[model samples]
Target chain A: MAPKTAPSSGTSNSFQSLLKSYIETTSSRLKLIDVFLLFLMLSGIIQFAYCILVTNFPFNAFLAGFGSCVGQFVLTASLRSQVNPANRAEFKDVSPERAFADFALGSIVLHFFVYNFLG
Target chain B: MNLVLRLSSALLAAAVVHAASLSIQNPQFKITAPDASQLRSESLSLAEKPEALSLGPSDVLKLTFQVVESEERKGVQPHQTFLRFYDEATGEEGVQPVRVTPGGKAKFELNMARPPTSLPPTTSDPLKVSLILGSSTHSPVQYELFDLYVPASQPPPAHPDEVAFAPRPEITHTFRPEQRIPAKAVSAFFALFVFWPWIVLLGFWFEIGPRVPHLFSPHILPFTASLAAFEILLFWYWVDLHLGQILLYGGILAVPTALAGKQALAKTSEWRLGRK
Candidate 1:
């Protein structure tokens, strides 16, 4: 147990350093997008857990909630990848402004379908 | 014409001779038990009926008679000999043919153990029995014999589809139970918990503080406003607006949004290139 705790604490220390470096190194614009992505993923996981732990009687509302989270997460993730400076070589044809436009369009379409199922 | 007139006259003479009335002679009835012991014995009068005869479940009733000419007392076979049993209360009747020998003697046996199918549906009331004899050469004769009190017959069998015509039992319906909501405390807890992501998002965004210098610019603001309008329109669609209205409004809104998006993206591309 003593040896196991030593390795576990070391891993957590390294994880904390990694997080600090990421916060310091990444651009604020990318962090903003990452925060929104984190929000979407957390919201999606909560909704899914609620469905599994509790009742899904109003299944359509659950579907709208969960589907919107997943759909928006996908669109936001793609936007993040396209606008990321490190991935500029991979997405040279997709500019940050174009990616934002695509995200806005995809979000509107996703919201339309989500609202359709909200009943 | 003369031969036809002679034939017609001869037929009229034969009809007047053949009009002699017929009668029954020595009509008798005997009811015996299954073991051949006599239960009842009587002679039926041609002018006056005998006492009503009763038969048990396994009784055998034997009736013997002879059809004869009333004036000559000569036996004559009838072309049609029938025994009629009638129920006056229910108006139900059954005609059973009695086989007559060529010498005018007729014997009919009613075995209670195996009653004839020709018996009508019966009750406790007595049935009026009558004998009828008809001959082509002699005039017809009918005589009321006597009443018979047999055991009441079993009721008629019900038709296979009889229940279909009867009033049916009431129909009942079962329905699924209504959906229920979770406890208010649980619901409120989940509702508040669900909004934690919003806190995380806002708190992190505040911490990161990304700059958006051209967000409110003429080239970018119109595009942002149109996108926001699309969201508001969708919310309105969820509240009350129908699909057709939403589609029409969205189509009209799309044109301006496309124009504004092209202008905004083009300007942003120029800025990006200039910074590079």
Candidate 2:
């Protein structure tokens, strides 16, 4: 508004480069985590929409579906934090193997309760 | 269980009526069908029982009846005619009255708004409806039997017969929601079985996922105790929802959402339950 400047090509290219490099540097484990998280999130959102549309006729079924999403979110978020290089300093004392084990155990325990609630 | 009893009783009543038919005939049906069957030489039967009829949702039957005036019986007591869906000993059902016009002709309609639920295809259970002509409570001037059948293809029957019954033994005042649910203690006990995994998860989640007490640790006692206490709270909550709290199924829906709150707290620690 001040000067009507139209010279932004250089900054836009730099932004694109920044995004590409960040994506390129991210580990496959973290990418896998992203994919899984996205899956859970999208599925959860779809199920929520269906719940709204059907008005939760089968409450157990609705709960189970929603629980899967949230339960997966808990497990996957932990996995993401552990694998993320930027967050490496926080969990430095915890090895990746140990972190994976925790995620696995947590997932099993969550699903166990989730299945019971579903019934 | 009541349905079984009603059916059995109806069958027994039908058997009794069939046994009585060989020797005795009620006078009420004397004019219904003048020559119901071509067996007048064998027996003076005025009306024959309707054949086993198979009825569906859309079927409507037009049945004819006549009230004959004979010189042999100069003045007989006029009887009121009604189509009873089933014999009284069998169960309580609808009684459709047949209107006799001044011309001495009467018509009865056997109609179904929806297919019967009780009648099975191979069922020999007589539809055993009674067409009774009577003015007194226990005495009938005449009576007739009509039978029908139902198939499973039809939607569950409308107005399945119901029998009036009394409790075997009286009990004390019944109050509270749990009374409505049978075996309250057993259901509550099994709920504890479900609590083990759920409580562990809650404990883990309550600790914010970073730290977790071992499943058998005393540290998780408070979590389990709180959850167990809340189990009763959950039942009462459902009772409230079902007890005219919401419109239609809204109560049923609130149950899972309310229960999900536990999981939500476990997964996100939105409300803390203090981790060990």
Candidate 3:
């Protein structure tokens, strides 16, 4: 029984190793996404700092600053989803053109509301 | 046209009602002479020279006597004595002694005697007058010197009523320093919830499923929706606290921050995804 358990444990370790190798070899957009996420995160942090330091006096400026970044982030994510090969299953019928249109429409609406609120 | 006419008529009616309710009235007053007959009183006015009547050794005393006879006593009674002071410079007369008796009898004495030579007459000085009667040498009566010029006769000055400029009532109000802490804390919390959490979730979503290219990933929408709800709540709370200005300024900050986030995300995404 002990000898049999040893083989199973060894097999489990080999399986984990194989999985790790496969993940390492696979095309990982994680780095790019991380960098993008980091940029956005840093921007949000800086704006938060501005809000704290500047005392939120010019509210429209702050809103415009922050809202545009969020809108861009959403637009970019949508673009990535529409254009990425991995997302073909979900957006198979949705062309990149349509995706771009959606992005544009979403951005327009976001900016419209942002402008109204910024003032 | 109908709506405009209705609105105009409503406004006109309001104006008419307002105008009809307004009224003006002038205040009224009554004037009557004092009942001196029963009181047996007499009154006199005096003029003084040199503007102010002053007493000195050389100043002459002028006396004007008005004695109201009692109702029982007819005419021609004992002599009524009065004292008066005369300003030698302006030739103005002053009532020195005014006497009113219980029977409403009054007398005035003008000092005509030259002031003592020892004391020189002073300019614009007040002259003291005393009326003596009934052999009461110890108790001489005195009266206030009447200003020959009345205040009303003069032209109104620039500040006729100087009392208006007097100090106003002091106001006092108190506020606790800690009262602002809650508002600031709430503002910060909402800011984080509305804007920061999305950035974090973006990072998390990428880490969990690196190959998944869905923008409307199930996770992202909920987080974004939560942020929206939080933002609305904060905005409502801000309005309730009368911190609308603060909220407005916060929104302004949020805009550029959002833009910068988008730029960073796009640049990073393109760099990683190998996209132009």
lDDT winner: 1
Candidate 3 at A116: error in angstroms?
A: 8.8
Candidate 2 per-residue C-alpha lDDT over B1-276 given as tens digits, one digit per residue, 9 for 90 to 100:
999999988987776554311112222221111223221112223467644555544554455655443423222233476766652334535566777664446665544454233323223244556556653222344555555553324332554443325344656786654323325564455335434544544453443333333434444444344444444444443445332443334344435434443443353332232431
> Where's the lowest-lDDT run of ten residues in candidate 1 chain B?
B133-142
Q: After superposition, how far is residue B152 of candidate 1 from its true place, in Å?
A: 12
Please give the RMSD to the true structure for each candidate, in Å.
6.9, 24.5, 24.1
Residue B201 miss distance in model 2 (angstroms):
27
lDDT of 3 by residue, A6-112 (tens): 99999999999987975686345534544555566667666767678545656676787677677767776877677666677999787554565466447645654
TM-scores, all models, native as reference:
0.69, 0.29, 0.27
Best by TM-score: 1
Error of 1 at A50 (Å): 3.5
Off by over 4 Å in 1: B1-163
Error of 3 at B212 (Å): 20
> Could you tell which candidate, 1 or 2, scores higher by DockQ?
1
Query: Between 1 and 2, whose TM-score is larger?
Result: 1
lDDT of 3 by residue, B53-142 (tens): 322322232333323222323222223334444445544444333444544344322222432322223345343333333211112223
Instruction: Estimate, for each residue in B4-45, the C-alpha lDDT of model 1 and write its tens digit.
Output: 999988997898677788888889999999999998888888
